[model samples]
Target: MNSFSKLRFRQSIFAKFTFSFIIVGLIPLLALSYISLNTFSNYLERYAVTNFEQMLLFASKNVDDLYTRYNNESKLMYSYGTNKGQILGETIAAQTLEGDYRLTRTVDDFLQTVLYTDRHLQSVFFVFPNGAYQTVTKQNRTFDFRYQFPDREWGEVLQQNRNLLSYFPTHLDNYYLGSNQQVLTFGRNLLNVVNAPGVEGEIVGSLYMDVSMGAFDEIFQQMMLNSKDVVYVLDQNNRILYSSDRASIGQTYVQKDSNEYYRMQKDNANVAWKIVGELYKDELVMRTRKIINTIAIVVGLCIVSLILVAIWFSRRFSKPIRSITREMAKVESGNFDTQVTVQTADELGLLSRGFNKMVVRLQSYIEEVYVAQIKQKHAELNALKNQIRPHYLYNTLEVIRMSAVANDDNEVGDMILSLSHQLKYVLDYGQETVALQEEKTNIEQYFRLMELRYGEHKLSMDFRFEGDVLSCSLPKLSIQPIVENAIYHGIMPKSGKGTIRITAEELADNLLCVTVDDDGVGMTEETLHQVRQKLESSYSLDSGGSSIGLKNVHDRIVTLYGPDYGLEINSTKHIGTSVRMVIPLGEVNASAERHNS
Candidate 1:
């Protein structure tokens, strides 16, 4: 062991700092630099190839979704458009414009419905051979067709391109917002023939649908997190489809490949679609170098001081009993203000300060450990109480008092009734949870009774809930007490109408949130700050609400669902107050409903 220790030679401050700076600074920069250049280049190559494959896959799915939506919407547009044409034809056949305005209102209504379905769609217009046109869609803010407007774009395209399906690349349009047309436009040829429908010379018109490129742009935005990374859409010839920066659109780039990134990418033809990402490895090494340099500079001076100390230490050790006694005497009287001002930066000076810090840390650690143990004991005791003793007795007593209600035993019944209500709440226990819908119902009944006792001057309750949210289970009586507090204390004290709106939303996480809000007198900053401090300090129900009632709800939520699911309160002056509970999608015991009042 001695030999091994000596193998690592005694390091001076200069040497130690050199090593430390290299370790902390130089290593990271170099590592990151290598990653950014070589490793990332290689990764990008592989990514490009893989993404090329993915692009095809994504395209297939995207095509299907787009086609289905477009086809459905287009068909509706065409059917209504064709019906208008037929009605117009029939009107002309019967010579009915002076008398043929029968289908005019129908045509107008159909066009309006088509226009209203999607806002982004520019227009759905019909063209005729005589260069006259009939457009039925709301093109912009303007309503109806541009009559006798020359059909140039659609007209020329129909003559040349015979394919029923055609796609146009990104191009600007001539109208208002449409002029800066960032769209993928689809044009299908519409035909009109005598008796049998024919898309011939009488190519009556076409269906025009423009889809915004915002979604594609959004996809690029999502992928490009770092400035070094870029997402590009390309045509078959590697011409750019679009870049986030408009200037880069239609431009091309030669990808730089490094490491296995290139090797992996070259073979995988679909790499373009995979979106391989890159990292700068050399930065870590470079950073390490910088740190080593700084440490060397600082430690070089420390080493010189250490050498001076070592020389002094050898000369001074024997004459130290009196000095040690004096230092100890200063320390004993609670004096950290005194310094151990010996002529050396060696053993005794280090030992003195080191011992002081050790004492501080030891005392702190002991206190922390003691507090933690107490908390654990309390939590275990609470858990034991949480699981034991159902609230069935309270439910039974309520039924007993109800029977007394039938027998007209008012005196004893009233006493039992009061106790039963209190017991039922206690017996339900803070650890228990009930269905959200059930709790709402219970709270509604409780609030209604409270209102009856207090009168309408207290507050207005805006209890609006969707039936869909009713099935969600929550801790029992969670909402009632919060509302009761607002009425008895917050709103009832104020003159104006205080509104409480209890709302629920099914969150994407599959958890449910119930928010109870009131527009009462609200609270001062002092109270809110107190609440925040209390929550941070300890896990107790004693922070917000009317103290006891809110404490009960908070305790019940936490016990039933763990720490993550609990109460949050927010309030504004004269505006309102809100209490929200986030409950997990978990099962409740069958006895919850049976034991309810």
Candidate 2:
């Protein structure tokens, strides 16, 4: 059964087409569903966390504003009293001296009025320096007068920092009997106003305000999205002052498991506390899972329908393809006379007609275009070889002439050697481009020959090249012809010693410019114009004048590269002549290197 299945997959177009349609349709559907699900989940998670952070920030701000209002009220005890211009602090201080029941009743009434202003305030206490205290409460609870003010740690802290307010963490109300309510406390010492200069006032007594956790609960209730959401208000030491879960209050808030929840936190601006919110992760995943399952079901239905359609289409099309395949096999065996019969007037018929036409044209092109190109290439190569032979013969004769002229001169032997090297380079048809350094060496050899020939003319040469310019590539024998022209036309005609400066430098747009300047007899403006006109023209008859070498160099540059690159000439009659040649740099060098390799 497995072998039969493999044979069906290999030979039957219907089976192959069905499998291809299934893969092409099913894989992308699965991949797209997976990607979309992940993307939606991530976006949903980020959006939820961002909203949670904003809610936490709003809650923190509300908590800060509440604490700030209470802190300001605590300072109001130092304000001047409503009666007789006496400060409230001084009145509270005088209660220590009066020791009367009516005065104690008046003070208690004032504290009760302050407590009634905010429903969150649970109790207020004013403890005197002698450990005697007065208190008020929201409910009728008996006071614990036996609780000594000087004995508690919070009392000592307030007594030490007389001018600053101190905060106490969440604790039960121990100062009142039968009151087990949780409260956050603030305490400060009241100071005696000093009228005499340099007389520091003493501490009359300390004031304490107790705030209930209902204040935090009311603010957090508005921000809860669901019951499963957790909110916590923590002190600087990570101790929970208030939480949605009441059992966790007064305990340290350890971080929940991060993989199962999204948590956000903000710090209260008015106090050293942090507000935190956590949301469940499974809720977000459930939403994404439903979308993914729907997509998967849709994709499965599409795959099954696609397989049925592919089977019908493949059966209809495979017969025409099989006929074309048989004819193509005949063509592969060099039977160009074969043709496919047009079975239907659809694309299959058009393909059959196109195949017949293509075979006929292919046969004709093999006889005409292919054979002619080969013959033309052979003819050109042979003509080039014939032209190189005469130049080789001429260089050989020149070497012999030099040897015959000065046999005793040691420099003549060296000249012959240089000539032979020049002949070999000139005849090397395999390499069309050479490195700039090799061309420079060839110019030096040519200049040596000139020096030997014109012994009394006193010709000198100098080369200045920029960084790595010598490693660049140019057409072989390109510079030597120009250098020879400069020596003959520019230097030989001058009256005094002549100096030739050759400079190579890089230019913009990946170009290289090589300039040859000679301090010799230069051309008049009219002559220079004529020379430029001849170089710029597309065709010119050979005149064998002094500018022939210049024209040759210009033609080779323009032919190899485009017309935008060529030789440029500038000359002053009394001063010198400058011939600048521009050529492309990096790409040309790479092409030349590839050809050589």
Candidate 3:
């Protein structure tokens, strides 16, 4: 029964392969050729659509550029009047026919400069509030409005439209052109820079600019590179203002044909202009059909030959490929010991060798590179543990301090407590810096411990912090070392009671100045010079055996802030020693770790 079932399964596999080979070898060629042709046709349609849309966008931009320039020309005149406090000197409302010709001459010169500088400007006119008007034209510097339109009707129209940039519907041909051609008029209410009677930003007059339709002809010519393409400029009402087809001008463009077409339109309601472009889809399809047919024929032949080769290749290729596939699956499952056996010296055999080599290399990489990195990380953790070894001492001291407190040896308890607190603050390798207040608290605790160790009368201390000095930040244990040096070296060696004063004060240029001063047996000039040389040199100092001293403190400050922030010591033989530290007045939530060597 098992043998019969196996025989039937083999037969089913052969049947499936035969059906698949037939479909893949022959049917796909015809089906794909048909599909490719349809796909090509669809692509051609999209290409046409995209091209027309881009053309319309270009046309819109060109027209917009022209309109923007025209608007800016008139707006420049308005802007000048508003900015300069006058057209030339006199106000727009102040300028009149009855006024001196100087005002008119200045205004004419200004407008003439406008016409000369901007080639797109055809004319500029200012209609005063008193029904009087002045004009500057590009026709010539000598010619004025009267030379072009020798009538009061134009002036009256301009005067009536005082508050708006009116767009005139009439053609410029009657007034300025010898033939009938459409023109657009853009006008705006002119404003004064400094209003009379103290009313600033007041409307004073009207300004008008004319844009000829001839400018758009160049744009249309550029867009109509293909004979089948159509372009139109429409008003807000969809009435054609300009078209590539002369007959289509003033007529509505209706898309009614069954043939494929691409359409694009850009509309600006503020200017009431719409640029529309259309391309015939038949043109694109006709252009691509020959190429499509050629490719289809070549692809069909290639597919037929490839299918025949594929059948023979599949029979021979299946075994090694299956073996490689299984090995690769094992590799994907993280079994890097899996290896492919090279069966032949062909490309597949070379691939199998490469695959086996990759697995071996992967296993070696895991053992070498990854394991080394993990061990390096462990070493770093160990180093961190070594750096924080002081924490162990701190914990032991904490236990001793608690025991002293329990045994009612209150002074010993206090001393142990302060020592523990100081240890905890100093040995904390977690942060790189601390606030001035925290450092001050730690210093006070240290001072208390010192006073408890040495009688307070024998060594007294004073702290004075001025003007927000506590908000600033510095390296941890920065101030405490200076205070320790002052107490031990400066004050402890004195005969009578000595005073140690620590002051933190705000200084000029965003600097916080911390001074540790003591009235003790001051150092001799030679000793002071040696101390200064020690501070200036790369020598390290030790305080109370374990604590870092002046040089380390100075170098840490300089490292954390800058060179300008380190210690400066000044002393005289019989006078007290003063060590000043200057650092920038900014706060950061950081603490000192291991200092950079």
Would you list the C-alpha lDDT of every candidate in the order shown? 0.54, 0.78, 0.69
Q: In candidate 2, how many Å is residue 163 off?
A: 2.1
Q: Model 2, 390-440: lDDT tens per residue? A: 456756767785776677666777677677667655654345777888789
Residue 360 accuracy (lDDT) in model 1: 46
Global lDDT of model 2: 0.78
Instruction: Give model 3's TM-score versus the native structure.
Output: 0.39
Q: State how far residue 443 of model 2 sits from its true place (Å).
A: 81
Q: What pairs collide in candidate 2?
A: none
Candidate 1 lDDT: 0.54
Candidate 3 segments exceeding 4 Å error: 1-27, 54-66, 81-85, 95-98, 125-161, 169-174, 177-182, 191-205, 213-225, 246-261, 290-597
Following a full C-alpha superposition, what root-mean-square deviation does model 1 have from the true structure? 25.2
List candidate 1 stretches off by more than 4 Å.
1-64, 81-111, 135-153, 160-163, 175-184, 192-202, 225-242, 248-597
- How well does candidate 3 score on lDDT at residue 181? 44
Q: Which candidate would rank higher by lDDT, 1 or 3? A: 3
Over 202-316, each residue of candidate 1 has an lDDT whose tens digit, in order, gives 4444555555666455444434223433444554455544545556554564454554222111111322222223322344334445655565565555555555554454335
Task: Score candidate 1 by TM-score against the native.
Answer: 0.32
- Ranked by TM-score, top first: 2, 3, 1
